[model samples]
Target: MIRTTGLTKRYGRVTAVDGVDLHVPPGVRFGLLGPNGSGKTTLVRMLLGLVHPTAGSVELLGAAMPRHAASVLPRVGALVENPASWAHLSGRANLRLLDAAGSGGRRRDRRRRVEEALERVGLGGVDRRPVRAYSLGMRQRLGIAAALLRSPELLLLDEPTNGLDPRGIGEMRELLTALNAAGTTVVLSSHLLTEVEALCTRVGVMDAGRLVLTEDLAALRTPTGLVVLRTRDPARAVDVLGRAVVARSGDTVTVRADDPAALNAHLVSSGVAVAELAAQRRSLEQVVLELTGPGADRVDPGRADRAGPPHQGDAVPVRGGVR
Candidate 1:
């Protein structure tokens, strides 16, 4: 569980995170979504006490952050931006060192903990090669493994599937689902809309450093009072539906109907053989695209020259254009 109120972080004249009030309850997979430099990473850092807020407060697992980070952070696992380890050391050696440095567990059990963590991240069979020799995906798995060393109750991950291949991404999804099923709270920040749609129960959207929207994924994707059906008799179906028909292409017909079942029954009764039918629902991509503006990484000198200087919360234009 995590909570923040009026959380604001500023770097001189620019605000990275502004007036954010976030609430993440236990037993839910929460996804944080935003474009690059939308203050997502900054907010994550503030939650973990890695970045101090210029104004407002942060609470992690019922305790104030930084103030109680020592007592609370040990029970939480995190991977921020990228994972780092001594390149010359073997994967096993690196994990052992991390476990030894962290709190909890007896010294004798450190090896078992490290091995278990590695296994959870699909690195159980890794050889004695130094971390520098590991592929990008391998290093990513290693970072996740290190986060699991403490058997944390809460996992706060940023770009969790960054370097993973399709198979590795699938494995990470399964691992996170299993962890959540076992009572660990999971929160992830990612640019992958489909990944978040598949893995998260709740979502929070950030734009221009503000928490623009937060809602249950199911609610956001609710039926749009329209039914799309594929039929052999598109012409006849269109005739029967009349004004209700909104779109048509080949065998598919989109009709403005509140109930797919009712629409299907009527179509069948009228001799329209329906092949497939379902209610129209919004995709996560649509939801996020509608809520957020262009990312901070995007800069157009011509647009800036035309529009003049940016307003308070607009993406600051780079003088020389995007690098």
Candidate 2:
């Protein structure tokens, strides 16, 4: 478990993380999501004591960070930014060296740890191969194996599959999921929305250096929008829509209303030929975009007054970070 209260960091005039209060309970594949430069890495670094925060405090497990970073880190595994590995060393050799530095007891125990880590990340067969000779996916796996060398109870992963192919990404997901299921508590930061939706049970979304939303993935997915309609008379259809919040563009109309069946039936009976009627929900990426961008100021659809656009700011979504 990790918790931060009012955690903040500043460099000159720039603020990387601002007033973020986060609570990550145990046994969760927690996802930290942000646009590029949104301080995901800065927050992670501050948590691990790689960078000191300007204010606030961090607690890892049950102990305070920075003050107890020395003792607490041994129980945590982290792969942040780019992984460091000796290119000339074999996969097993790299892990062996790391395991030697952080022994779990006997030499046999260390070796077993190394072997199990390699197998867990799908690098056991290639342990004998030099890291330079391995593909990007293999090298990524090797870095993860190094992190698991200590059998850490918590894993902090930042873009764990950044350069990997699709298959490699899938493998990384499975490995991380297995680690969490076994009670390791993995904290993941990824730009891949689908990846987060699939692997993370809970998520904390950051925007403009602020922690905007932290909730269970199921509850966070409640916003549905854009009921699409294709009718013969676009103008008449708008009136036939009654008091339902509606948006019209040429022959197509989109409404915030949830029921398409009643609306379709009304339009048909009113002599307004209906071509297509579909009620669509926002995709995970779309939801994230709305939550982080200027649309964050928009009201809920149920409160929408037919004055707001169907969607906004997503064509060229805000891509800047706090730093």
Candidate 3:
């Protein structure tokens, strides 16, 4: 339940976010996908009133932002960038402190919320342990628990799976899925396309401070579907399938045609022997790169120098980490 129109943000002469429009429906996990310095964090901050936009408008839960942010934000929970916690406190204690400060619930209610959050994030048994003793995944879960302290209606998570191992990532995915299924609106900003593909029904891709494309994940799929045809003579296959392009290994030819079956029939009739014919589904990463242009993998040289060389630990901040 969020909408932005011509949303623009600038820093002096540089426009970090430019004229982006976004619409998110209720109870959906929408993904904001972009590389570093693509204005994803800037947009999220503007939505939260953490940063004021130079132009355009933002509405959250049907109310204009900043003017109504105070009332609306209480219903919104966010974990921006990397997870943050008081290193000395236990996981449960960290959430308890937040609950005491802003959650407005009683002791028993707060405790139940903490435990449920921990359980949802797969950290139930370990909530008694100090945060400093927890691993990166645990800390991430704790951050999520803190966000859920008040049973927020909207969750804004940035790079939620940044440092997790495979299992931890899967758990995070499952948790988000369940949250959305239970009617929580989730806006997840991430550079990991595969994770977004699995979690989000809709995706927005940003580049050079502007939203280049927003589409349902299903709409991004090829109209004809993808086909990978293998033949004894790769050269002949390419010649036979005029519209096809040879994939990375050269032996595999990828084709996007509206009628793959007809193409197969034509190839067979043309005496082109096909050793293998399989559908090649486009991954979210491939579709995003295609829509955002070929240089999607290229990082901003300026942000790279400013953020410093990447470390082994999490580089993203707990909130608005990209700044």
Candidate 4:
């Protein structure tokens, strides 16, 4: 439901998003992953037409961005970076004002929509206390509730779970999963590996302002032609398998076998009582590290000195707006 061709943004000579070609299909939780200064937020802003691209194009919901933003954006809800609200106003008051400012819908249903949004974000029982009194997690949830005020078909969230605790994070995951299941396309932008692994169906890794890798989570985690099994007789299992056994530790044996079921059968037939067995697969961390270089957030002055004078684009400043 989102497509970009050669999408790029430049701050003078420094590029924030460089010639990115991204495709996100409908009915999936797509994760956009990167480090602190890897341009994930910049890319999300460009997609929402909040930041103009220096070169290339963006398409959302089958329509060109900015050009047709007024028509398309109403059907899209977004929460970029942090959610902002008047600290002095109650959460419900803030949402009421926001909903009133937007076009479309009958005025009579405003209260109903606001209540539904609050309830969806787990703020249904919240009192009318000023937002300044709300905790960080409460504020985060309020922002998510604001985005859901419209019940848009598409959700573009950036660092959605910033200040949430473990329980709050889990609740957000469940909420996002439920939304996706109900046919709303979700595009989540974050640097948290665990969050993406738990919530996303597809993933795109970004580094140095480039879209380095994109793949389905299942495909990326495919078995690595190795089977790990725990048995009471590790030595006996190793002796039975011979060269096929790659490593052994105490009661565990790792075998280089393509078929796990066949390997298990052989081990059991040979008097090897297997306790636990599973195929080895590459973790998302391994795949990301393999495809991308060090995070752009880290800068080594010694390396820079050895490399001589830095290029203009080499030191891309990550200000609040750019991030």
Candidate 5:
């Protein structure tokens, strides 16, 4: 439903969005992936006609942007940056105002749309509460309700779960999943890779100002049939596993295996001591770095720094072998 070619946008000498072409078919939950300052928001803005691109062309719902923004935008919903609502107004009140200003239809129709949106986002019961009294998650749902006020064919959300806790994030994911299952195409832009993995069917990776890669999540997640194993005796385990061994160093061995679980079991059955075993599947994060080359992770070092340390999800505990 959206296509762009050679889409370029610049702010003086610095190009915020390079010549990137994006194709989003109907009914796909698309994720735009990037680190901070990777031109994600800029691309979305250019598509929405909120920002004028310095070069290239865009077609939204088969109409050229800005030129046909009025007709096309009514079918596109967006929550760019962060969505805001009048603090003093009730959630329903905020949506009512948005529906009137944004969709422009009969007052009765708009009112019905407001109720449907509130119910759709699970804020139906709390719609009477003022927005300022809503939790961060509730406010986010309200923002999405405002977006859905137009019954948009396509929904654009930038970091929809940005500041929410784990529970809130889970709720947002479920809501987005339901929306997509109900046939609204969603384009979600996020710096968090895990969220993209959880929510998107197709993904586009951005680096600097360019689109480095785009692929279906399944295709991109193809297993390499590689496994990394830490063993009490690497040499003996390698000898026992025979041709499955790929490389060995210290007490660790990398093995070629389509099934790490079976391989681990076999090794233990043969009495090879496995300390830890982990599949070496290439993650989207790792593939992104490979595409962007070295130092890609340093784009905004301070961002990662401020976020503190990374998690230890990669390591698997296999004290006695494949536990």
Candidate 6:
């Protein structure tokens, strides 16, 4: 539902986003992950028509941007960075205003939408409370409610889980999952690797103003391994499986294997412990580092590796337009 070609943005002599090409299919939860100053927010603004791109084109829901932004924006809901909310207004009042100004819903319809949105975000009871009096989590939920007011087909959330506690984060995850299941296309940008691993089906990693890698979540998972044994001697079992280097806390001996069942049968006939065995896979964080290059653990894992060879047609220079 979203596509970009050669999308570039620059400030003075520095390019914040360079020839970014992205494609997000319908109902897919695509993630834009990058470290600070990697141009994630800038790309988002360009997509929303809030910032003019220096070059290239963006299309959303089959319509080109800026020229068709007004027509397309109603179908999209966005919470970029921190939400803009009036401190003095009640939560319900804020949503009501958005409904009126953006969607032009009637009084009764707007009220119902406001109430439903608040309830969806778990803020039904505090709808009457002023936004300033609400906690940060509450305010974040309120922002989400406002974005949902129009029943948008596309939701763009930038760091939606920022500042949220564990409980709040879980709540947000559940909410977004429910939305995607209902056929809403979601594009989320987050610095939290664990959250992305849990929530996103596909991800695009950006660094140095370019996309480094894009992959399905399943493909990124480390392969699982299994092992087997035969002899009852624990010492012999350890010795068979490289005992000196491999550490065994209890009954199980941990070793990397491609086929656990095969290894188990082989060990059983070899006079090793004929007991049970299991397999373990590396975490998502490790896989991410491996794909994006080493030192990613210390550097921002989200940063795209733009220093590599330039993508096709990306070398073509273009001029920036007026805001």
Worst 10 residues of 2 by lDDT: 314-323
Candidate 5 Cα deviation (angstroms), residue 138? 2.9
Return the TM-score for each candidate structure: 0.92, 0.75, 0.80, 0.91, 0.79, 0.82
lDDT of each: 0.85, 0.76, 0.77, 0.84, 0.79, 0.75
Worst 10 residues of 5 by lDDT: 314-323
Candidate 5 lDDT over 1-323, as tens digits, reads 88999998766556667899999999999999877677887788778877777899999988998799778877878887666778888988887777777767799998899899888777778836677888877877778778887777899888888668888788889988988998899999888888889889999988778999989998888778899999888888988989988999899999999898998898999898888998886788777767653323454445432111111212112110000
Q: Which candidate is the best by TM-score?
A: 1
lDDT assessment of candidate 1: 0.85
lDDT by residue (tens digit), candidate 3, 1-323: 99999998766566778999999989888999987767787788788776778899999999998799668877888887677777888988887777777656678988888788778877778846678898877777778877877677899987888778999999888888888888899899998888998889999998877899888888786444667887777777777777556452556677766566787887788888878877666678877777663333455555432121122122223331111
lDDT of 6 by residue, 1-323 (tens): 98999998876566778899998889889888876556777777778777778899999899999799778988888887777687898988887777777767578988999899989988888846678898888878877887788888999888898768899899999999999999999899876789998999998887767877787877766565534333356666777667322555556566667777776776777777566666665656665555443322344556644332222222222111001
Judged by whole-model lDDT over C-alpha atoms, candidate 2 comes out at 0.76
| Ten contiguous residues with the weakest lDDT in model 3 | 305-314
Ranking by TM-score: 1, 4, 6, 3, 5, 2
What lDDT score is found at residue 51 in candidate 4? 76
User: For candidate 2, what is the TM-score?
Assistant: 0.75
How far residue 253's Cα lies from its native spot in candidate 4, in Å, is 1.6
Clashes of each: 0, 1, 4, 0, 0, 14
The worst-scoring run of ten residues by lDDT in candidate 1 lies at 314-323
lDDT of 4: 0.84
Cα lDDT for residue 69, candidate 6: 77
TM-score of 6: 0.82
Identify the runs in model 4 with alpha carbons over 4 angstroms from their true place: 104-107, 303-323
- Runs in model 2 lying further than 4 Å from the true structure: 223-279, 293-323
Candidate 2 per-residue lDDT, tens place, 22-83, comes to: 99999988999977666787788777777777899999989998899768878888877666
